[model samples]
Target: MGYIDLEYAHTCHVKSVSDVYSLGVLKLEVLIEKRAFSQAEEEMNRDLASFALPIIEAGNIEETLDRRPVPEPTPWQLHALKHVAQIARCSVKFAGKDRPTISEIIANPETACE
Candidate 1:
């Protein structure tokens, strides 16, 4: 659930849109290759979502992704990663209504599987 859900979350108030937040968190986990909030690291910015948001906002999402064994990402991979990051960034909107509905997400060019 998102901030809105957290604010008024109960069995009755839960809605399908709440899953949008879970999807966002899943996206970030895939991109970061780490737990959403782990004690494995000692740092002020331990939340992957928070850590990745600014870079995504500034169009530097590539910098936030896990380093690869390959020398560099291929053009297709990089493009795909960018799209995935954008979806992840969009998924985590503070308000549930602000997040994309499942249909919108599935149909979105950036998020839809190519």
Candidate 2:
């Protein structure tokens, strides 16, 4: 839902971690349904970073799930969301070697399912 803006004299390369971070932010936006700027100040708080790590580690991805009741998501939908969380986490691993390659992800699509 968002695009990266990179200014450079030559080709710009984006890291997998940057992509993961962007996906995380997008996921949060969908779940929260509020303007990003509305919570910009709070988002910068160090405490939120600490809180996020535990939730990510505990597999509590559903905590960020959208609560809107327009059309209830099926179990499969929930599973898919969890899968995305896992992928995002893996892509953001501290060590680049720990991350899966784009081709690997494409070949193992089911890994994204809960």
Candidate 3:
């Protein structure tokens, strides 16, 4: 998977945390409507996490979001999107230990949107 956790390079072993991280990348891909890696004019833009994480952490996740919704997102929808983005942010941390458990990632978004 293009979304494989970066820490896999050193360990060459798969861990549950890596699954969490990849799920997070999937979440971001859904939100941003971009693949983990793709053809783009800028090299950095080729990777969704590299391109969007800093923007997300910088508090501008909306900038990375897909904007094709017909009427634009409602406030509630925007809130949910932001919450999911936060989960994605937590999922893609460089260190596996720094990433949230799969359960936390799963629960947080459901609770957050409530």
TM-scores, each model vs. reference: 0.75, 0.54, 0.83
Question: Between candidates 2 and 3, which one is better according to lDDT?
Answer: 3
Q: Judge candidate 2 at residue 32 and give its lDDT.
A: 36
TM-score of 1: 0.75
Record all residue pairs in model 2 with backbone atoms less than 3 Å apart, i.e. clashing. none
Each model's total of backbone clashes:
0, 0, 0
Q: How many Å off is the CA of 1 in candidate 2? A: 15
Poorly placed runs, candidate 3 (over 4 Å): 39-41, 108-114
Flag clash pairs in model 1.
none
The C-alpha lDDT values of all candidates are 0.68, 0.50, 0.79
Would you list the rank order by TM-score, best first? Answer: 3, 1, 2
lDDT of 1 at 6: 34
What is candidate 3's CA lDDT for residue 6? 83
Query: Tens digit of lDDT per residue, candidate 2, span 18-80?
Result: 554444445445543443333357655332223344666697867666668535568888777
Please report, as a residue range, the 10-residue window in candidate 3 with the lowest summed lDDT.
105-114
- Stretches off by above 4 angstroms in model 2 are 1-39, 45-53, 68-72, 111-114
Quick one: ranking by lDDT, best first? 3, 1, 2
